[model samples]
Target: MNKLLEVKDLNISFHTFAGEVQAIRGVNFDLYEGETLAIVGESGSGKSVTTKSIMQLLSANSEIKSGEILFNDRDIVKAPEKEMQKIRGKDISMIFQDPMTSLNPTMTIGNQIMEPLLKHRKLNKTEAKHRAIELLNLVGIPKPQLRIKQYPHQFSGGMRQRVVIAIALACAPKVLIADEPTTALDVTIQGQILDLMKDLQKRIETSIIFITHDLGVVANVADRVAVMYGGKIIEVGTVDEIFYNPQHPYTWGLISSMPSLDTTEEELYVIPGTPPDLLHPPKGDAFAPRNPYAMKIDLEEEPPMLKVSDTHYAATWLLHPNAPKVDPPLAVKERWNKFQKQVGSLNGGK
Candidate 1:
């Protein structure tokens, strides 16, 4: 697949009264055409910030210290406001996490969806409304014609989200960034929303960047996974590679913490310690404080992303050739084995 977007050496900071908060620290990743790339991380891990930067949606206090966000061979970070305006909704669109906050309560559903069509597509009132109803129906809202006339409060939470997705997809953007789109919904609704997105991906052929900490959701939707920690991508690989053959200790922790059907234990595993404070960032590996297998080098120097395979790489000293071979935690190992078997069984042992 061709590269749709490439974020290289991206660094972002927020100038605050306290100090400069280093939100994104030299982050790099690629989003391929027609692929769902899931950015998994704890809150404040720079997942949303990174995607937000792609859209140039940073706040007044936020600053892009340095980086290049290449989208379709154009560097968005250097693009003028006029150029960005042309690209925002037409070329790329984002579905925010909360529909209540994203959608205006005063406006009718049809008008909200038509807003982009009018602004970006230069459609007339009648044409935009016609497109809005089509979008509503496209996202699986029954009786869209009738529903379009109503306000956001008239629809259920799931329906509200569907409306939001419709608005995001109104212009047929090449890339869609969903920032924890399912975080506010219930489990059953979450499944429906995810299924809807995957269905849309196939029909629209648009690349999706899904940002969330839910590994379960990642398994359901993602083609590739990028694990982020301390404002950096600690590991990145295909779904099978990250889940079955994780290299970074942080990746192992995340996989092990995911709820498994094979596990009978009542208590779930949780990674210890909070993420590092970015104001006074650590000198070495950011995850070293919580990593049980961390060595002296992890405290003194940062580990480069060591290639584990053609498609897999992890930033951890443990992946170094000279580093002593150490097994992942017992719980993690067991969970990986169970997941591998589960996947194999599902694939008919092929």
Candidate 2:
């Protein structure tokens, strides 16, 4: 449980014609060695923006107003471009959602993977070429020798993703950020990719930051989960805690919305209302507008993150001592029970 990456009070904003969009507001989390942490939220919830800021990959209009991103005890936020270049692929790497866009269309797969080895490992042409084919094989690509010579367009979507993963693992980074890595694939392919990532993680012992909106995806790959909303984390806890004893309304909605694997539900539950606009952000709790359990205080004041357990924390008035106790929807409770049974079975009924 060694700490690999720490993001403290990280804030990111964008300068647009209309106004400054506060994309990430005081978000905080830590990734431990060989652990997978999933950041789950709806689109525009700052899931991608927060992680992108850590890599200094924000767009030209976006600005890092404040906060510290400490990687390996070094303040990466303050590091120069040259220093970051060395760290990007050597110590930390990212796999974007669309592999086709991320990969160079004109470059051969072999040359693309070899680029990192040549830049970071200082490998000669022959050495880099040999390692490139080895990486392709490592990612389960068939006929690595012939495949390496082909262009990206020659591969299928799933195969292209394997190439993207190969590039990310080429440098053997300590931390890997996967931003919706399996979003564009079919369900079966998505499961295979997720399993592959887990298997690779076990072999390499690398910490991963998995960003996605799919709770089902988180269930398989994540050790811990951070529930985000309106540019802030509303709940942070272990996978079991968040799944079994969720405290935030947002977290409850997300769990209830998950397509049940055990039950026959015709339609999936969707959270009501839309995410709040960041231009003129709410003065109080940003989620108040969409929260079904909102109280009078919820519209006038924001709640601080309350400690529910040693490792679990949630930002909601429902956890306050003076507030009346409430229960989540029946559907959510049912899902929690099913999830518990699954976990128990996996742990040999412990």
Candidate 3:
């Protein structure tokens, strides 16, 4: 796969009345062409901040303290606002979490989709309207011609999301960032949106950065997974590796917390303690406080990304050569074994 977007040691901080909140502390990742890379973590774990930086969409109070966002060899962090405008909806685009707020209540859906086409693609009115109808149809919104004229209020949550997607894909963006795109919909609708996005990716050949806290969604849509915690990426691997061989304690907790298909347990496993405060960022491993398997070194020093495989890396003291061998929780281990067995059987060998 072609390396399309590269983020290197990206540090982001927000200057608020409280203090400087170090939201992203030396983050790094890469996006490949025509692939979905899911950024998974807890709500405040810097998943959104990191991806938003790719589009240069951080707020006024936010600062890119360091690092580079390289898209097509162009440094996005250093790109001026005038240049960023061309990239925002043309080269890269975003689908926000809430479709309710993403769309304009007063504007017709057609005009909304056409706005980007006109601005970025510089299509005239007649050409833009034709493409708008095509996009509406492409996103599975029925009766593109008639539905195009309808306001955001007329569409259901799922339909509204399709419109939002249409707008995001207006210029056939090279990179598409879907930040919790399916969060606001029902289960059925969520599935539909996921299917639609996968379909669209194949059709348009766009690389995707999918940001979400839901590991289930990550499992469904991601080619690779980057698991973040306490504003840093604690683990990253191919989807199969992350699902079947996750190494980080936080990744184990996240997977174990999901409601199991085979288990009828009423209570889900929760990771103990709260996330660390970014205002005063931890001097050691950021996740040490919440990690049940945390060692003395975990509290004294930050762990580097230890190599598990060429495609897998995890930052934890447990991955150290001198550290004691400790297994994940029973639930996590069982799930991992089950996943391994499933893959082994599919490969027709042990």
Clash pairs for candidate 2: none
The alpha-carbon lDDT assigned to residue 157 of candidate 1 equals 93
**Candidate 1's residue-wise lDDT over 238-325, tens digit each?**
9888887889999988888876666666657889999999999999999999999999999999999999999999999998889999
Compared with the true structure, what per-residue lDDT tens digits does model 2 show for residues 1-350?
88989999998999999999998999999999999999999999999999998789999999999999999899999999999999998899999999999999999999999999999999999999999998999899999999999999999999999999999999899999999999999977887799899999998889999999988788888999999999999999999899888999999999888765565665567888999999988988999998989999999999899999999999999999999889989989777667657657754898
Clashes of each: 0, 0, 0
The CA lDDT at 134 in model 3 is 93
Q: Could you give the C-alpha RMSD of every candidate to the true structure, in order shown?
A: 2.4, 2.4, 3.2
The number of residue pairs in model 2 that clash at the backbone is: 0
Error of 1 at 285 (Å): 0.5
User: Highest TM-score among the candidates is held by which one?
Assistant: 2
lDDT of each: 0.93, 0.92, 0.90
Better of 2 and 3 by lDDT: 2
Residue 271 in model 2: shift from native, Å? 1.0
State TM-scores per candidate: 0.95, 0.95, 0.95
Q: What are the clashing pairs of model 3?
A: none
